[model samples]
Target: MDAGEASVVLEEISYFEAVLRMLCAMLVGIVVGVERGRNHRPAGMRTHMLVALGACVTMVVSNYLFVEFRPLGATPDPARLGAQVVSGVGFLGAGTIMREGLSVKGLTTAASIWAVACLGLAAGAGYYAIALTGAAAVYATLTVFEVVQRKMNVTRHATLALDLECKDLSGVMHDLNRFSVQQNATLSHVQFDETEERGVYHLTAIAVFRGANPQADQAVFLEKLGGNLNVKKLETTQY
Candidate 1:
């Protein structure tokens, strides 16, 4: 291209425009993070803000490279760089997920992190409407709609109090998680009480089961969980 065309391309993103995109990205991120922070999630306000800002910076740099190096016969794909951000952000999301005792936490936080990244990309790409709307939708899902569910008294899960006695403690939690998955149950809470007798420990947990027949599933869950030689006894009561 000629000098005039190259100059026009170079001036596409002025300093002001770049700053605006970055700031918008942060605003979008903050909007989404507020709900997470309020809920005491693993990835809170600052973490989401940083992820959004970093994604915006990445896009800005990509646009800059495309404009500056187009005159030098350099074939740089900005979308490729953006794709890296999409995939690479998964590691950050994975960091938020955690297993404690018998329960798993931070799935929602991980999803929020991914949503924040998308909002940042939208802001960076100058799609302000999409960014704002997406943030609003996420915020509503976290708050307003949740309140509606509570008011409506939606109880889709069947909670069960579990009593398990095991001789072998090793891999007990792992086995519990595996069997819960098999029975389509989620472990929300767990407690371990060891008796004076050696090699005997009591495992108690609240398992939320989801199925057409939760009561029937309970018996099957117990059978699978106690099938192991290490597990001596298992009982469950629906609540």
Candidate 2:
């Protein structure tokens, strides 16, 4: 083949390679997203796949622009576009995070999304091994680490909000400690607020519940507190 024909053939091969990279990126995204989807996360399979695909396309386009404009002496910064992808992905990640009362949720989902974007960039850069490895690592973390975390009782602290009708703090504190001990929960801190109407006070307590079945233990504690003649209302918030 002539030189011009040979160049055209090589260019076609390169374009095909780019397409393969994007497909690999999408596959990695799907692998990561499956775990999140099974857990019913806010940003699940489709979101993860799209994020990776978008990042991969952006990277491909960035390189394409450099080659396309090279004859015109146009300089290209490939990393500049990738940097924007990293920062832009944050908005989607942030949307997955949510705060409910004292508890925060969706952190793992947000982290997974960020990781997926990185995987996409890697695939676009033709780092197939790294991208595949990252996908496996992320999936194992979401699945295996979850079991380990629960078994370890890694999380313990929960907040309890109590509204009680009481004449004195001493009586309430005594009963509360008794309830805490029985339920295997430690009362770390307590805040008291008296209502405008006399003989009513609101107590917010931060506590750490040990062992499994924290919700059951919390339920038992609430039941005991409600039985107190001085307690008009009681609720639990996990932090």
Candidate 3:
């Protein structure tokens, strides 16, 4: 074959290899994304897949372009591009985190996004086994570990604020304390405000409950407190 024809053939082969790498990266991303999607996470299949694909493209460009145009004495550093991918992925992860009241959410989703980017880098570097294994491990952690955590009865301390306006402050405090003790929760702080305009007493209590079922206990407490004759403006929070 002519030299020109041979060069064309080599270019075609390089293009095909890049396409293969991109496809592998995208497939790995999709696998990880599917697990997050099943859990109804914010960064689902599409987001992960795109991140992976983008990383793969960056890697391919760095590897091929640098090698082709690098100076005679200068060495090409392929890892530099991959390193940038890690930092870029952080921005995508930050997008998934959300703040709602006192509780910050989407941390897991952010972590998943970061993981998918790494998987993309692996695929781009032609490390198929490593990328696939990492994806599998991440999926297992999200699904199986979450189940184990739910079953394990882990307790976390939190402060709850409750407000009530009642005619008989002493009786209300007694009932509230009794309920807190029944659930193995503690009322660590309490404050009372009285207004002469309506002749009512406002009581705010901060309680700590076991994290395993704080919501359940709080629901029951509210139901019982709702039955009281003079209770009003009742609210609770984890802050």
Q: Best by lDDT, which number?
A: 1
lDDT of each: 0.82, 0.80, 0.79
The candidates, ranked best first by lDDT, are 1, 2, 3
Candidate 2 accuracy as lDDT? 0.80
**Tens-digit lDDT string for candidate 3 (1-239):** 34454456447438778888889888878888998888788888999899988888887777765555454445668789999999978988998899975468899989988988988888777777887898888888888888888878466555567777887888888998898877657886688989664768988777776746777776676778878887866766656
lDDT of 1 by residue, 50-105 (tens): 98888888888888887778778777786777788888899999999998644588
TM-scores of all models?
0.67, 0.79, 0.74
Highest TM-score model number: 2
Question: What residue pairs are clashing in model 2?
Answer: none
Error of 1 at 220 (Å): 19
Flag the better candidate by lDDT, 1 or 3.
Answer: 1
List model 2 lDDT by residue over 32-69, tens digit each.
Answer: 99989988999888899999988888877776665555
List ranges where model 1 is wrong by over 4 Å. 1-3, 148-155, 158-161, 164-239
Regions of model 2 farther than 4 Å from truth = 1-13, 154-159, 174-189, 211-229, 232-239
Model 3 collision count: 0
